[model samples]
Target chain A: MELFHLVLRNLLARPVRSFLTLLGVVIATTSMVLFLSFGEGLRRSLAQELSRVGPAIQIVPEGMEGLGFSGYPEITPEEYRRAVAAGKDLGVKRITPTLFLVRGGFDPQTSFFFQGLPEGVAPDLLYPGIKPQAGRLLPSEEGAIVGAKVAKRSQLALGNPLRLSPRVELRVEGILEESGGLADNLIFVPLKPLQEVLGTENYTALLVALNPGQKAEEVARALEARLPGLKAQTTGDVMRFAERALRISDLVRFGISLVALVVGGLLVANTVMMSVYERTREFGVMRALGAKRGFIFRLVVLEALLLASFGGLLGLALGSAVSQAINLYTLGQVGLALSAVTFRLSLFALLVALGLGLSAGLLPAYHASRIPVVEALGRV
Target chain B: MMGAVRAENLGKRYRQGEKEVVALEGFTFAFPQGSTAVVGPSGSGKTTLLNLLAGFDLPTEGGVYLGEVALHRLSEDERAEVRLRHMGFVFQQWNLIPTLTAWENVAFPLFLAGLPPRARKERALDLLEKVGVLERAHHLPSRLSGGEQQRVALARALALDPPILFADEPTGNLDAESREQVASLLFHAGQERILVLVTHDLELAARAERILYLKGGRLVRQEVPGPSR
Candidate 1:
């Protein structure tokens, strides 16, 4: 108890030095938390977006994978029928074929990737839980369903005519609620009207929903084997590709976080070492008062641990506030807000702070414990 | 029980670069209850003898005993325990921790001994009152004068009610009036404990029951104050 009192007094004795050290830890911890949280949020948002595309296998034209944004290459009607037949033979539950038509929006300079689905085949099966927020579902071939962002940006109201081109005019039947991803940015139209506008009798991709007990990968493989010119990709395979695309940014964020932690550890070590140097005579006095070497060691370590814990908590609040601000700023532009901080992530950050404190204090505490009593006394 | 310290054929050596320096050698003495003074010049190893007696340092060639226990033969932790239970020290610099208030400094030893907080505080206040510094108990060492700091240090040394006490130049940094008051307190405090003081002041040395003179790290003679001076 006396030792603890002395430790507190010592820390309070040099308030400026202690505060500076704490500030260093706070900055480093804040950076680490922010970068790591951003990385986690980005990864989770991508995963959620991929998952929302449904538990179906996307069968695209084989060479379309390398095409950047020219839109999915059209597969012939004959080939689409053959793929659907093969999927049905493999116990598929449903198959939704979608045509991609890239056309200018109301503003001729801005283009929208318009998707066309058959009138009876529900787009809800491809994007589950997506319902019209302001109007009924598509009721006619000329009717269109627009995503929330598209509607907001275009200011299109229900029953309003949206002209994609001179020959393709459709009435806005519904506006979707925010689906939290790219789905909130698309415009859906009836397949036959879009096909008529594009003068095509084919779709760009087929979404195959397998039976409950069927494996997606196995069905994908079977479709690829039976349909020679089509590429069948399970959702997991798509997610893996997305993850690979995100790897560089994740690695960079991780490296920055690692540097921040190292800097925090170094700051702790330097502060402790300086404190030990300043209190040599005081420690000797404690030694003469019958304090063991271990007592001195524990005192130093306890001081560092206290500083780290306080700094970590403050950093967490600061980092979370900054992340929330970023989330608010990006939600409107990107249609996906940053992920919220979890309790587990907070606990992990605190644990990292504690581990850094212990590691940084080890050498300083050992040095404090090893000071020769007589020599330390002679300092005064 | 009152404890006694005895040093037998004690010697201490220091290595300065390649040269070996013998600081103290061939010292032999036994101290029972009451006061004794060790007088020597700056390089005469007076502090070395005190350190060995207090078990703060081990002798290079001999051993010290506290009652029936061989102090030098024990490990560092055991020596620390002995110091806590049986010995108290006052150094030339009034080595109170600068961060602690005088009261906390006085209560340090009791805290080390695992005494309850109420008991430690009461005992510390009592000792501070005895040393005439109870009113300064809340002041830090920096706030206290040199004499008051030394008095608080004295109270701290006696905190655990140790059987033996050692003071090294306790009045070296004080004015004449503070010195006289501190010296009076020291002599009165030594009435029931074995007190060994290391100092260069002959007048202070003469007040002790026995005075040992050292030269060239060796004890030259022992004397008792007398009219013959």
Candidate 2:
């Protein structure tokens, strides 16, 4: 502990060098934190969105996974009939076929996610416990219900006119309560009118709901076998696929961070090596005054660690602040916080910084300890 | 042999590039307790001899015995331990740690000896007061003038109260008044211990009870001052 105190004093003596070294570590750590937070946030959002879904399985075009908006709706009316037939004896509660469409970006006024269910199918079939914060769910073919975030962002209220195109017009009959889930970002429209807007009569996907004791896995397997042209994914299956994709993204992010981390290591090494070089004589003086080689070695190593620890802490703070700022923008645009700095990530980054310190400090510490006492004292 | 240093035919050789340069050769003497000075001109091996005697460098030939320990046979770590526990050093440049305050610098050796913080501070403060730099106890070495830094270095060297104190041109960089003050402190502190000083200043050498005069790398004359002050 006493030796450590001396190390702190030694670093304090050269504040400029220490601060510059610290900035290197901070930049690396902050970049890493910001990069990985996206994975953390996506994982959290996906989990919440899945939990809010009332159906146990989603059958979409082979490439379209879950409710994600992608590719044109290609499930023919015949395939939809086969999906319903596959679940006939499987104790299926409801197999609601819906159409999904999305358009626009950057401009909230022009952007929209439109979920089209058969007229009078009730939004509760897809989103359980979804309460109308104002008015009521779409009660007829000429009205729509807006998700809470969409209503707030686009400044829509019940009785406001919504024009999907010049030919398809509707009134906002309801505004959803914020569910803190995917339901908070969708706009529910009647299926027939949406088909008219798209000029296509094909459905998007089938959301399969099973009875309390029914097995979703067995039903999904049966549907895939009967309707082989389409893919049936259980809630777990969708999550796993999403998670796998996320892991790949995570590896890419970590790979990018490695470069910054290496630079950080070099910065720390350069600062510490320079310190060791400058203090060679001082070390010799200490050696002559009864300090052991280990003493000098430990002093150098401790200085590096102290520098890294301070930088790592500040980096975590900076990363977290920047993450919230990113989240603020995303929450406004997508109604989802797309970056989260988690506790585990914080711990991991700090440990990595310390590891960097140890690695960077070792060679210099060895050199410092090996200098003969006489040479050091003689160095003036 | 307590509080005594025995040099057994001490010699040191260095390879300067391709040529072997002999810095010291065949000089053997048992320095008894109390003060002694080694006086020589430039390139006369005073510093090399001091280095070997203090175990800062190993002798190429022969050995140095501080009390009963064969310093030449000890490993580097063991020699360092010996220095920490039983040796003190003062140099021309003072060599006080620039980062530490005057009293902290003095307390450092005590700290290496595993002294507790409170005890280290107390002992350091007492020594600083004795050296007349108590008021500058908390001032860093850079903050102090050259004379003050040297005084603090003196206090540090005396911190362990070891039997052996090595001084190499302790007053070489000081003004006359500072030199006198440092020399006075050196002699006063060396009265009961074995003090070995290397210097070119004949006046400082004459102050020691005994002086060895060196020419080149060999001692040609040993003189005893008529009376010790």
Task: Highest TM-score: give the candidate number.
Answer: 2
- Model 1: runs farther than 4 Å from truth? A46-71, A74-79, A99-113, A133-136, A139-143, A157-173, A179-182, A190-204, A210-251, B227-229
Residue B199, candidate 1: C-alpha displacement in angstroms: 0.8
* TM-score per candidate: 0.88, 0.92
Cα deviation of B38 in candidate 1 (Å)?
A: 0.7
Predictions in order: lDDT: 0.82, 0.88
lDDT of 1 by residue, A122-212 (tens): 5576788888898865547888888888888778889899776678789988888987766687788888877787678878788788888
Predicted candidate 2 versus true structure: per-residue lDDT over B77-161, tens digit per residue: 8888888777788899999888889999999999999999999999999999999999999998889998999999999999988
Docking class of 2: medium
Off by over 4 Å in 2: A105-109, A157-170, A196-201, A214-227, B1-3
lDDT of 2 by residue, A1-380 (tens): 28888888878888898888999999999999899999999988888888889999998878776565666888887888888887888777778888887867756556788889887777877889888999897557888898998999889999999888899998999999988777788889898777888889888888899989888888888888888778889989988988999999999999999899999999999999999989988999888888888889999998888888888999999999999999999987777888999899899989988999899999999999998787777731
